[model samples]
Target: MTGSGIHLPMQSIEAQHLAELVEQFLELLRDTEIGEDAALNRLTPVVYPEDADASAEFADATSADLLDRRAADARVVQAGLVALGEGPDAPQQELSLAGSEVDPWLRTLASLRLVIASRLGIEADPSPDPDDPRLGVYEWLGYRLDLLVDAADELDGV
Candidate 1:
C-alpha cells in the first residue's frame, strides 16, 4: 500500500486464475435463482432467522438488490484485475487499486470466499482438511482477501 492505494504484483497465471474465479462468481450470481442453490443462499443473509415468513419476505424484498450490488462489485474487481496479466505475452502485471476501487475489491473478495466456503460445507473451521484439493480455491480466495484487507486497514489509518 502506498499513499494512493494498494499495488499488487501478480504473475500471469495468478492473474488468469483470479480472472477465472471472478468470472465464475459472476456467473453464479447471474445464473442461479433464489433457493435454487445452497451456495447462492450464502450470498444473502437471513434477516429474521426466527420468523420464517418474515425472513422470506425480507429476502423477497431485498435479495435481488443485494445480489445486484454484489454483481456490480464483482465487475469492479474484474476491471481492476485487468491490470494483471495472462498468457505468455505479459507473463506478469501489476494492479494499483485506489479510491473507490478498494471497497468494491474487498467486498467482492469476501463474497467470493463466502460462496466458495458455502459450497465446500466449511462453516467455522479455519482449516478444512488441506488434503482436500477442492479447498484450494477457497483457501486462495481467503489469502487474497486477507492481503487486501490488511492493505485496506493500513489505508484506513491514513
Candidate 2:
C-alpha cells in the first residue's frame, strides 16, 4: 500500500464486478432527474422526515445538488476503475487508489450497496431471503465497504 492511500490488488473477477456495479450506479444517478425511483430515493434520503412541507422544501433545494455531488464522486471512482479493466472480457490488473480518491470510493461503494439493498428488499427486512441471488450481491457490497473503511483508516493513521 502506498503512503498516500489504498493499494488494493483485487482479482480480475472482483474488479470487473465492481466496475459493472459502478456503471449501473452511475446510471441510477442519471435516472434520478426524471423522478425518484425506490433505489434512488434510498440513496438520497430525506433529511426532514417529520414535516412533509419541510421535506419537500429540502428536497427542492438540495436534492439536485446532493445527487450532483454523488455523481461527481462516482465519476472519481470511475476514473480509478478504468485502469482496473483489461477489456470487455479480459482480466483486469491491479488498482492503486490515490489519496484524493479515498472518500469518493467510500461514498460510491456505499451508494452501490444502498441501491442493491433497495432492490433486494434488504433494507425492509433485516434478514432477507438467503436463497435470493441478489442477496449475495448485497452481502458482497458490504464486505467491500468494510475493506474500504479499514483501508481508509489505515491510510489516515487512525
Against the true structure, whose lDDT is highest? 1
Model 1 scores a TM of 0.88
Model 1 agreement with the true structure over 1-158: per-residue lDDT tens digits: 33688777666777778889889999999999989988889888898899999999999999999999999999988987774543236766677788678889989888988887887778876667777775998888788888888878888788
lDDT tens digits, residues 101-146, model 2?
A: 8889989888888887888787657888789898888888788789
In candidate 1, residue 94 scores what lDDT? 73
TM-score of decoy 2: 0.88
In model 1, where is the ten-residue run with the lowest total lDDT? 83-92
Local accuracy by lDDT, each model: 0.83, 0.80
The alpha-carbon lDDT assigned to residue 114 of candidate 2 equals 85
Error of 1 at 108 (Å): 0.8
